[model samples]
Target: MRPNKRDELVSKALNVFYRSGFHATGMDTLVKETGISKTSIYKHFRTKDDLIIAVLRLRDENFRSWLFSRMAALSDAPAGQLLAMFTALGEWFGKPEFAGCMFIKASAEFQNRAHPVYQQSTEHKQMLLEHFTGLAKAAGASDPAGLARQLLTLKEGAIVLAAMSVTPDPAGDARYTARMLLQPYLAGG
Candidate 1:
């Protein structure tokens, strides 16, 4: 089914924001790329910030759904699913359209934590941490919170290094680290 005008605008704006940047992609660019007039854009989104929030919401929903579903499909064991998260990320990084993470990009552009965009990024990360924590607990980790923190670090680093390097395999490296860190929990240690 075809998306409504607002949804279509948000989708196009997300791609533009991902390719250029939240701050770099101007209203005029969105108008031109979406083939919708500035008036129409304002009708849907009162301001550019509103549009960005919409784009981020769309990205968050789509990304989480994809990542979690992929992780579930990859492994039946809780611990295996934990490690498979990095595998999923590796495949994502390998995609032709791969750019760094959208939340990371948003954080970089919107440094002020008080800002709505940065807060949205933080919320996205917290959700990831919660997911990791749940997996760690289910896998019988002694310290689920700590394990989640360590894994999140590995994931974030992999994302950054993969985006920065010319021929990156940061995901593989991160998964190896994650495997090592998750070892004790798997062994009932």
Candidate 2:
């Protein structure tokens, strides 16, 4: 198979995984969706677990790059950048196909703490926290680490509410809450 074929398969698999979920999706389903032979699929990914890891890694890299680019375009003021992050998240959650956070969805599929996917999900959250921490420090927060942690909690809570509730504006509501939380920090800055 061509190199592009491998990429195409992964991309298709990601969409399937995101929509139907990992445990619900099978290799046969992926093969049928991608119009690729099972043999071709195996040639690229030896096992279902391997494919899942690759898809998750791709997701993490894409999210990190997209976030960094968005953050880079904001004001040097960390508070502003932090607010922008929440705004971006709101917009994302409001999308028509937004079923909830990919990592969060995947984490729910596994109850086992030792699962590799669980570790990957945890790493994704940690990366977001680290990014927020850096932004908080740059914005001149008195306690960047604390502010970052708080923002993460706010974001996670919003995601959970959006996923579980019938409200259409979970992301917007969450951003509003985050702004309220950050007001004191911004005033100090």
Candidate 3:
């Protein structure tokens, strides 16, 4: 089925944003990439920032769905799922088009805390941290919040390292570290 103009614009905008970033990708470029007229684009989104926010929202939904589904497929145990999350990251890193975290990039570019893009990016990251915190709690961590923070650090660090290099498997390293940190929380430890 053919996508509506709005969906098509958002889909194309996401690709362009992923490749050229929100700040760098111009409206003219979006017009060319999406093959949508400026008037039409403006009709759907009042401004480029609005379109960027839409793109970020799309990314947040898609990324979370992928990660959660991937983690679910790996294991049922909370501790196992926490450790296995890196396996999902590894799969993402292995993708040829991997270009680091979009939310991270957005937050970096949209520095103002009150900015919508920045807020969306912050929310995306916060969601990930909370998700990890939930897993830590379910896994019976002695200090669930601390473990969540530690695990989130490992996860984000791995993302940065993986994005920087094409060789070394940062996800594998993160998984190992997560396992070590989660040891006490696991049933046998």
Candidate 4:
């Protein structure tokens, strides 16, 4: 089924926000980029923040779906799937449109913890943590929570570095570090 106007607007706005950032992309910019009139956008969203929240939700769904599916496709075992996440990141970083994590950008622009946009950003990361924790448990890590947190740190750090161009291949660097971290849990490290 084709997406409705609201969904279409949100989808277009997501690309705009991803490229230009939350604060940097104004309503006018959104209108121009998304090709959705201000009146129509307001019909679906009460405010810019509301539209931002919707866009973040769409981003979270798309990102997690892509990352998880890529991981699964790369490996059959739970532990291998965990490692394959870095491989997926490598591919994403290579994309011409790559612009780092949108959640990170949103939280940075909306710094107040109580802000809805910030909370939404936090929720996205928490959901990711939950997924990592589940994978760690399934992989039989003695301390699943600990492993998950470490992996999340590595993942976030890799994203930052990749976005900054601080290193030629942060994903490869992350995968190397992840191997060391997961060595104990792997069949033979």
Candidate 5:
């Protein structure tokens, strides 16, 4: 099926923003990549900043849904679900075209605390934390909040390593480390 115009724009914009920093991406690039006119693009997205916010929102929703679906497919046991989360992240990191975390990238570009994109990135992180916390609780974790925080730290650390030029397999290493750290919790579960 043909993709809708909004999806097309989003897909193109994601690539542009992912390859080039968000600050470097321009409407013209999105227009050329999507084969949509400037008017149509603006009609859907009032401004470049508006489009960026939309893209970030779309990215957050897409990532959350993808992670949740993977977790759901695993056994109802919390241990299994937690392990699956690590595996899923490893798989994403292993993708040939995998770039560093989009939220992290955007946040780095827009360091201002008041920046809308930066705030969206913070919200995205919080959402992930909540998701993990819920999973930890379901798994009968003794300290669900703590476990979630640790997992978030591990994930963010891995993203940083992956972004670095020296760390090959940063994602895989991070997954391994996370699994080791969470092994006790899973065993308790």
Candidate 6:
């Protein structure tokens, strides 16, 4: 089935926001990039924040789907699947269109905790944390929550370093660190 005008708009806006930041890309830019008039955009979204939330929801769905599927494909066991996250990150970082973490950018642009955009960004991270926690439990980690938070931190750091070009192989470095972190949980450390 074809996407409706609102979905199409959100998709287009997501691209624009990914390329340009949330605050930098104004309504005019959105209209120009999305090729949808302000009147029509407002018809679907009461405000730009509402549109951003919609875009974030789409991103959350797409990103989590891709990451989890890649993890599962890369490793059958839960322990390996946790490490596979870095492999998946390497693939994503290598993409020509890679522009760092959208949720990170969103949170930076929308710093106020009360802001819906910021809350949405927080929600994205929370979901990832929950997934990591579940995987840690499945992997038989002694401290599932601790391991999950550590992995999430490593993942986020790798993303930041990659985006900033701070390291030539942040993903490789992160994967190595992740291996060490997962050592005790593995069958034979």
Per model, how many backbone clashes are there?
A: 0, 0, 0, 0, 0, 0
Tens digits of per-residue lDDT, candidate 2, 1-189, equal 456888788888888999899989988898889888899889988898888888898899987788767766764567877877777777667777767788998788975789988889999999999999988887778899998998888888877877766676766877787788678656454
TM-score of each: 0.94, 0.90, 0.94, 0.96, 0.88, 0.96
1-189: candidate 3 lDDT, tens digit per residue: 656889888988899999888878889998998889999999999989999999999999999989988998998889888888999999999998899999999999999999999999989988988998899899898888899889889989999999889459999999989889988766665
Estimate the Cα RMSD of every predicted model relative to the unseen true structure. Answer: 1.9, 2.2, 1.6, 1.3, 2.3, 1.3
State residue 33's C-alpha deviation in candidate 5, in Å: 1.4
The deviation in Å at residue 70 for candidate 3 is 0.5
In model 1, where is the ten-residue run with the lowest total lDDT?
180-189
Best by TM-score: 4
Q: Is candidate 2 or candidate 6 better by lDDT?
A: 6
How much is the lDDT of residue 81 in candidate 1? 87
Highest-scoring model, lDDT: 6
Candidate 4 error regions (>4 Å): 1-3
Ranking 2 against 4 by TM-score, winner: 4
Task: List the candidate 2 regions with Cα displacement exceeding 4 Å.
Answer: 1-3, 187-189
TM-score of 2: 0.90
Write one digit per residue (lDDT tens) for candidate 6, span 20-45.
99888999989988899999999999
lDDT of 5: 0.81
- Model 1, runs deviating above 4 Å: 187-189
Q: How far out, in Å, is residue 121 in model 2?
A: 0.7
Q: Model 4 lDDT vs. the true structure?
A: 0.92
For candidate 3, the TM-score is 0.94
How close to the true structure is residue 132 of candidate 5, measured as C-alpha lDDT? 86
**Per-model CA lDDT versus the true structure:** 0.90, 0.81, 0.90, 0.92, 0.81, 0.93
**Candidate 4 lDDT over residue span 21-122, tens digit each:** 888889998998888899999999999989989999999999999999999999877778888999999999999999999989899999999998999998
Cα distance off (Å), candidate 5, residue 161: 1.3
